[model samples]
Target: MLVYGDIETVQTVKEKQAAVAALLESVRAMPPGIARHGTLVTLFIGASELVQGVVDAGFHERGFDTLAPDQEAGMACLVRLAQEVDRSWRSGFASAPPPTGALSGLRAFNPDQIIRTRQAEGYAFYALYPESYLEAARSSGLGPDTRVIGIRSIGMSLSALVAAALGAPVPFTLRPVGHPFEREVRVDPALTHRLTSGKSGAFAVVDEGPGLSGSSFGAVADWLEEAGIPRERIYFFPSHGAPLGPQASDRHRERWRCAPRHLVPFEDLLLGPSDSEGLAAWTASLLGPLEAPLEELSGGAWRARAYADEAQWPPANIQQERRKFLARAGGAAWLVRFAGLGESGERKLAMGRKLHEAGFTPEARALCHGFLVERWHDARRLDRVPVDGGHLVERVGAYLGFRAGHFPAEEQQGASLQALRHMATYNTGQALGDEAAAALTTSLKDAEALEAKVRRVWTDNRMHAWEWLVLDGHLLKTDALDHNAAHDLVGCQDIAWDVAGAIVELDLPEEATSRLCELVQQHSGYPVHLDLLRFLLPCYLAFQMGACHMAAGALGEGNEAVRLRRAAERYRHLLRQPGIRQEQEEAPAG
Candidate 1:
């Protein structure tokens, strides 16, 4: 028996250690005969020596012989496995000798199998960048017309070498839009035009493995289609299945088969049927299902409904008036931030459409608005203009009304976490202050109760927390949350609770303030919301200082008096603005 946990997926050193430890412990519990011989293999491709050392030490301490294969060793292992490939046309897959150890299964098949399979199919190889398949691709003796396009990273470098070996006449590469986790794959427009410009032949889109989503291949397929290439010309040659070599889903195969596109499984070329099926079943059982496709939900019709709901004031009407009113007024994109009676009308309208399309309509609307606070604050800083924060509050208040009527208990709890975070980071007290506090208190109480329910439901279950929030897509308007998301919400709620406690009394500890600000800044960079947190840092600090000074009073004369005056000055400096200024002005001076 062998156990392996690739360290690539984890985010931190501690997490990697924990994962290794868990694997070791699991290995320990097996029967002595099996456990004693079990070799713990840690594949640290592209990992640091420090990480490799830690994994080695951890495994060594457990009295297990471990192997952390290097690039040379890994590539050597692939070549060694490829040596046994039966290139003869008469050799049936079953007649081929099975590969074992370092070259076992689709996940660890010989990289050369890619070129071998392509040769067998009579099509040119198109290796996706970032997989260790180049040595095999290069050695396969393909003609000079092979074309490979991928990212300009290490995996792609190896791929390029293989392409060069094949005497590839034209190889194209482009930087993907963002990190792989970001799931944003847009090939450069120039690259797209270049790829589609003149070449005409059957081309295979090669990738190392079609992971759970098969998204990399899908992205290329989409790009090719957009570039006006017939889908029939595109062939998907995923070298392996997903990480654990899961079976390609019927849906995934169906998707690729559209427009007569072919999905040629390299596993079929690389592994015997029994071993491939066994590995596929094992991985399929492990991963269960991929995230539901958001595209399946209709976007156009939902956008229409969202537009119709805004019958009161269409953005087009506002834009028309803006053009009529101001001679030098900019376009809608420029005016969207400032053009609204309450919230940014254009933003709200656009976000409403996004929410509806995502199937998180009613509840997502709140998350979307919270996202805007991030944008508005960023614009405030970059533009160096005092934007009205009260408008944000108004949008939140409307969402609150919607939440009260439509949100499930679980969703309300999740929203409560957002509410608490919003209040703490944005100084909700200044704009909606007392009202915000009252809402925070109530939402916290609800979340605390929900937290208790969560504990009771999963007391002994160590299931990953993300599973708790997978919204039922069947329920069109349900909140989009999974247990993992639920856990995230709870964690944020806990942090927000601490920050809110400190802010309400103006006795915020420096540590608490720093933590609150850190979280806000970290979350601001998240894809869903940009620049939405910590917009009220200065205001909150001033409020805290004012409260401290007011509490100290005349007991501390000179410095305390100075602090009090400064606090008052900060209050005057606060940009209450056109939204809340009228109500604030009429109130008694504190």
Candidate 2:
């Protein structure tokens, strides 16, 4: 929950614009294909940044709240920018440059700075289409007098579609302020006047979620109602019509229960009768004509399909898992998983290829519309199979080593030793006790120097037993890509992270842990620092515990949530009693 989307980056408009310009040049010159699709996604990201920058500038401008004539003109420009992004998306999915330079001569109209939010489900984890918003709005019975308010940051783009659908003026976006469970929007007198100036038929609120909490929507509605807008006169345009997650407050639940909310489900958009480019259509392009209906494989559904008995299924945090489906085509079953759009997807796809080529993972076929279709192995995960401790360490070592050596990043973008240690100690104190946590990191006397010694690479952040697959006498790693670049604090890191992760995840003893370290050093030529691993084991445990807690909250009070909570405790146990790690081999020769 918090791990992925919580991390944010701030950048100047000029920097992003420069990136856009460079990407545009590359995209224009490149041939139409998978690689070109990545360039288009990069361009799309840059264009999106420019749009956010302009919107940010407007809100920061003193007179923006008043709905001044100049500000409205700027809003129109924002709409155009959104349109440009849509065009780029079209090009990306088509894997071809637009007939003309789509927004090639896009006017310079952005703020000095922009705050970028990670686009998770819509951009990375799901096949959510912006067009779905347009469709959702068109189905509504709202009048043109309805005031359209978009919740930033995604709502900024989604509001455009809703406004266009209702033939309303350009929509103004508001960023909800505060906690995920309780949010409030601070509006100036002028913005309030514009919102309440006329007794509009309704005020339509637009955004993608009703996520774990519908607090963002609650914030906007709370502001509007306090401003004297009648509840009935306000419409909710969430991405889905489903009730909000269990974390939704009573106020939000009651208000949303009777509220007029509208949505066009992803199911409809992707599998609707009229969908021309649905999952079946696009997936067929990758694996030939489909011979079966797509099977849902996310939320640990793959366990039911792959394993013979329910007892064999490993517990997974349903909320944090990626979106994937099973497709049978070309005489074999394949997995069509959401790889992400543009750069995010492209990067993950590339890693998937690397993992496959290294003989550590399954083969990926092609990327179509941000989804990667790969050979779906029906192999049982390590949990269901007899895991040979030595073999497990060997496979995990070579896999982590391959990742460390082959997937080096340009810089040390991962969480630093100090940061990781602080997080570990703090989180462990909260979860276990302050005394136990401090000792785990005591060996890291000179954190800065040790951190400086470690090399940075796109880490294999996921080293759980579920990640290992026993297929065709080979141990294949599933979900090999996407974690490092995911919206999380654990970005690129030293190969030490993976080594430590493998040791903790498998609860490896000293001998096996030493073997893993040895295999990793042998394969990657990256020295294995036992002292560093000692520091990292706690850091890794703490991070996983935090992630599990966040996910458990999102999942609420289900068996799955309970399972996640137990997993968090398991992580805490490892933190409390740093077991076999205490019995370790000497640090490998550098």
Candidate 3:
């Protein structure tokens, strides 16, 4: 049975023509069994006309007798449901800002790049927008018995994809009313009856973009909740990234100032929200007006069930803008490992470490360094005391330091400070360890005095609110130990490998327990703290696993011993490096 819905799918005259062609092609290819059902459901006259065309053409060409929605009882029910939803939407109209916050730049909506890497990476591409959306009935984690409800258009597609992935049938769609972009959605009485009649359980709420004017998706979410569905059980496979401002703090409050809570911009879905509204506005200006509710909204067989509303269509210029935007679509922000809500230093560091483990050293270093630099810059910006001086003096003194031939005192602390100190030690002209030691001692001598001065500057009641804002915000965010943590974590791995090699080759046992405790004391938060736990556990596991294999004689031939031996040799070689030698020599002499 065909279910006809909204008329907004085909707006301008050109779209009408295209819709007709696509409908004919899809209908002509319909399976014999489905055609034999003889019912083609449509929502409004605009949709009914197209179905009638398809039926007339089928009969004239192949002697097939297909019934239109109005002619069949089951199909008529669907049309009635669609109209009921439309009437509800017309009663309530709320305009919302476009979901432009997500699409802050031109290169934010490319699905191709994201999908291309899906096979090589374990990203949730197909899971997010299942290819079998038309037939899926359930999702994997949601269990086989679960059912889903979708918002019309994007939600419908997402539900279908999710259901298909779960080896289920097409999910039910909640018909939207009024302008599709900013409509109030209503649950069809029939659907409500079907859900309420059920032996009561949770169902999923699927939508492509949670655009502005959340009433459509919100209606379904509310209905599901009211129907006794647990909030967590109401699965939201929103194809787009979250709407802006849901998680924004004062720092990023202005990021997507006017972005709609429901709207999911193609840019935002592919790329995380823009850092600034100017970037989002510029992207909008470049792309022109928003045409379709989403860029991926297309003329699929399922979409043909809905009718066209010319009056509610976006302007021609907006249509043109969409075409132009699609023509230049390049990269998606979601393609990257992490692109959501708040900025996460832990996720960034983990990603960097993962890259390093995979032998992508340059990328790993770059990722780690980028995060460090960002944090350091944030810290420096926070150290401002406008009453003490303005931007010029602060920048010069914090970075260049007033004294000649001296490093900026600001550089002594923050996320990258440890790495900077290490680099300095390794690259200096001093003797292997003596000069580095002397420099560190000298730097520490002034530490107590610098700390007191810093505390006074920041806590001084004379500072303006704006100045304190920067200072308070910085204090809350700056991490002074991330670099130290990274070094220690990487060092632990190296030491494990070194100790293993020493035991087998040099017959020496290198103690690692004390060094580990010291490392933990250095980096205590997320990525670093968790990283030590994750990396250290794996190292111990690998060592034990290899040892067990050796003891069991599993390493007699082509077993893990061969791999362990190779690992030992690799570590032996690494330990001979100048940096490794320095680390071992300067290891507190314990």
Candidate 4:
């Protein structure tokens, strides 16, 4: 009984032709009695060209027969023969001479002899031969229980070698679907005789590797049926390194279930979905007695807080204070350790002390620490901010200050004052000398010009509407500044006042001032009292200084000096206004 399936051989075209030639020679050499009476069967297993080539090779003519590889064990001819014989078959039958010299020319004969020859030449022939024979056994319906003996082949046949190793019968011709080269090879007549004599049962084996796919598995299913191995007894073991992508896993599982009941599917232990709940359950079952918990790792919130705080410039002695702030904000200890501070050890120590002092509950602190460590170890894993730049600034401001009421005051004061000084120098330096001196100088003589304006607005109180409109405009255009800094500025009124004051103090052209006021009014929604006051003071000071400087140039040398001194006095006086003093005191120092 010949049972076989064809496979596309992974060999060159010339090697395939050689296999066909070798197979023809082996068939011709069979014993005259058996050759004439025996039913030679061939299963066309691969592509059309190879199948046609096999038929043309004449294995199906004369006493040869053909069948489609199927899944029912009883349907296979090899299985029927094994049942009929019910015992070990004998070897050493005399066979006729070769039809063509192809077998002799190619020296393709007696795989058992080849194994011995190869072994004598110092090769591990015994070890290499078993896998081939085992493949044959699996393909022919012989399983672990089948006793294969003295199997041999002319060339390397993984299936033939396995059969030889197992002392199982090597069929005269075993065709494995999808393996073209193996399909075409000739088995040793002695090995074939031993297998056919019913000493050992028919078997078949399928090699599963990286490129094995749905179709390959299907072919194996068919072979198992033809080999007479009960479908449930046949197992398909996937290679260890095969990667199981989500899509591939789904496809493979579907196909495996669809296969015959007798064919069992075994997956390599290493390959599976990383986050698969099913896999986790399966692993727990396999562990039998002991299993460790699979813990979920921490996420990124704490890291965000650490980054936010680090962006600001620290105060001279505020390291402790900053650390306390961070701790309250859920900072982790690792954050302090990994913070990219300059060489000064002071900053690090201060941060540590602050964290220690902060009164975070142990659980909260632990959670925060876990988050920090996770983020520190895998920095790229941080979640990205979802809001756009403009919206983010507003949202952050609301979160940290407006909603939480956690604004810092000292930094705002320092930043605002410095901005004002810079603006003053920029505005004054632009007009050191000018010929409109006399008229401007005379304007300064009216020292009440600025005070008069302020008193008028205060008395009327109607100007508040215009001020509110200007603040609104500023709010709308807040996106014009850096988002992170703008959020900090918006949360602190003192910062807003300082920025407004800087704009006014610069003595920027009237058009620029108008534009700034218009923008603020469009965005801010309501008038900010401190900001308006700060803006008014600078405008008043700039006007007074400009008038005095112009007056000084017009007055000849001595009077010019006096006018300049007066301008300086007026500038200082403007700076000392009640509103300005309050704003400065309230502003945060960096």
Cα RMSD (angstroms) for every candidate in the order listed: 23.0, 4.0, 26.8, 34.8
Q: Could you tell me how far off, in angstroms, the CA of residue 487 lies in candidate 3 after the best superposition?
A: 49
lDDT of 1 by residue, 1-590 (tens): 00001111213444433443443344344432211111111111112121323333333354432232322243333233223221111132222222224222112322222110001000111212121244345434445564555332222233333444454533443223333323334444664676677667544455454443555556666667778877766654444433311334454456654633222243332222442232222222223321221111111122232233322211111101110010011111111111221112223445444545543333221211011110100011101222233332222223222322232232222323233334333343543456754553443344333333221111101111111122221212211122112212121122222233223223334343333334432432211011111222222333333333333342345443454445444432442321111121111111
lDDT of 4 by residue, 109-145 (tens): 2222211111110011111111222233444444545
lDDT of 3 by residue, 16-132 (tens): 334433433443344432121111111121233332232233334433222323123322322332332222222321212112221121112221211100010001111121222
Assess candidate 1 and give its lDDT.
0.30
RMSD of 3: 26.8
Which of the two candidates, 3 or 4, achieves a greater TM-score against the reference? Answer: 3
List lDDT for all candidates, in order: 0.30, 0.72, 0.29, 0.28
C-alpha TM-score for every candidate: 0.25, 0.86, 0.25, 0.20
Question: Looking at candidate 1, what is the lDDT of residue 157?
Answer: 32
Model 2 stretches with alpha carbons more than 4 Å out: 1-5, 21-46, 53-78, 81-121, 143-145, 273-277, 410-413, 434-449, 549-562, 580-586
| TM-score (C-alpha, index-matched) for candidate 4 | 0.20
Model 3 regions more than 4 Å off:
1-140, 178-185, 188-190, 199-201, 244-590
Per-residue accuracy of model 2 over 430-490 as CA lDDT, tens digit each: 7867676566557555688777667888888888888788886578888777687665677
Between which residue pairs do clashes occur in model 2?
4-487, 41-342
